[model samples]
Target: MSELLKTLLVDQLNVEVYQNRKVLGQVAAKSVALKMKEILKDKDRVRMIFAAAPSQNEFLEALTKEEGIDWSKVTAFHMDEYIGLQASAPQRFSHYLKERLFDIVNPGEVYLIDCENTIGDECRRYANLLTQEPIDIVCFGIGENGHIAFNDPPVADFQDPAIIKSVELDLVCQQQQVNDGCFTDIESVPTHALTLTIPTLISASYLFCMVPGTTKRDAVQKTLCGPISTKCPATILRRHENCTLYTDIDSCGAVEER
Candidate 1:
């Protein structure tokens, strides 16, 4: 394993910096694999949530190839999905996960948020499923605007009561989809999405946040140095007891070691 450039603990959250995305992903995946092995020691099945984006490419790729994980004993869930995108759409978050992780691992079960269903009905259904078991882990990333999942600054609620909800995507959030090359243009991105709320994401027993790229520099700065507020939704990560933020030199731009 490559040595980390720096390891900072902001309250209960751990931030690990590496020379680049590939190394960061490898280390993060190893950590996740070890955690899964530990959890499986006493549990028959583990539930996990995943983020689907180009930013997660390396991490997910490394994770699927990690040994010791009985993929059939894991239940998979995705963090968010565009409201109108078809299941076959390459831009659909579910399709992204299927291609990158699910197909390779073939988990025991995969519960995807139904974007084609009635918004309210789908939220209720997915939320109910989430409550059926505690989430063992969540692999996610911070957006350029500091959003987590689809919980953009304008829509994030730290004390949200619902486990899942439909939210209108903020302009910055929509533009990020384009910046990540998930969509050709801003107009092509979905205006709204079904997302696991802030409270739901934090409910996981462990969180592995893989954020790598210069584009996330500003958001990373605010997430670590700014106030713990919804203004920079990713800031809430610092409050989680078992959350770790994995970053590369490009993303750790101005956030000095603590």
Candidate 2:
């Protein structure tokens, strides 16, 4: 077993775990489709958290192709957006999500972060919106720093009081965004962003984390093996009752699961 898996085992942790390198992208895509269908089966009004990143392209494509979802009944809330970015900007998470998923499904409602507005007020407004209804599922990705939902390494608080906040981007996290093609280079990437706090995500009924590529291997290992600390923000998922991590072969590396 890999050190990451060993650590998880030694800690006597509890979480529904599934790791795959074989047919990684396909498995993740299929799993997401099934989960969406499962959630929509009984609930007429469903709310979800949408994540935008290159790693999620395949998964989102698979979701868009899946039939039978009552798109009109679903509502979506964006997980994060770049601070100072206009909704029209190509780098905006809102634009990315709309082109990839929302435009295809035409959900009942789509709440995007207004990054251009006063950052603090926007966070509070978004928080109030999240409180209006329970989220059925949240789609997310792991940052190269093992962060989740833009909640960078040093700022991620499992018990954060604010539902959303403006955060300064760490070097690793910013570079990862650039490397993923969200920007031409590190200098072009935004220095700050608005992100959903760890507590807000933990409140969700379910969370699906999709992380692929070898570049993320170390992060995956750290998040899976490291202590449940803000340093490894994504580790908080271990406390979630219905959280899932989906990764491709290169990303899984030495982690063992049969």
Q: What C-alpha lDDT values do all the predictions have?
A: 0.93, 0.78
Model 1: CA > 4 A from native: none
State in Å the error of residue 133, model 2. Answer: 1.3
Model 1, span 9-44: residue lDDT tens: 887789999999999999999999999889999999
The collision pairs in model 1 are: none
Q: In model 2, what is the error at residue 165, expressed in angstroms?
A: 0.6
Model 2's alpha-carbon lDDT is 0.78
Worst 10 residues of 1 by lDDT: 249-258
Clashing pairs in 2: 21-249
Model 1 Cα shift for residue 225 (angstroms): 0.2
Give the CA lDDT, 0 to 100, for residue 116 in model 2: 76
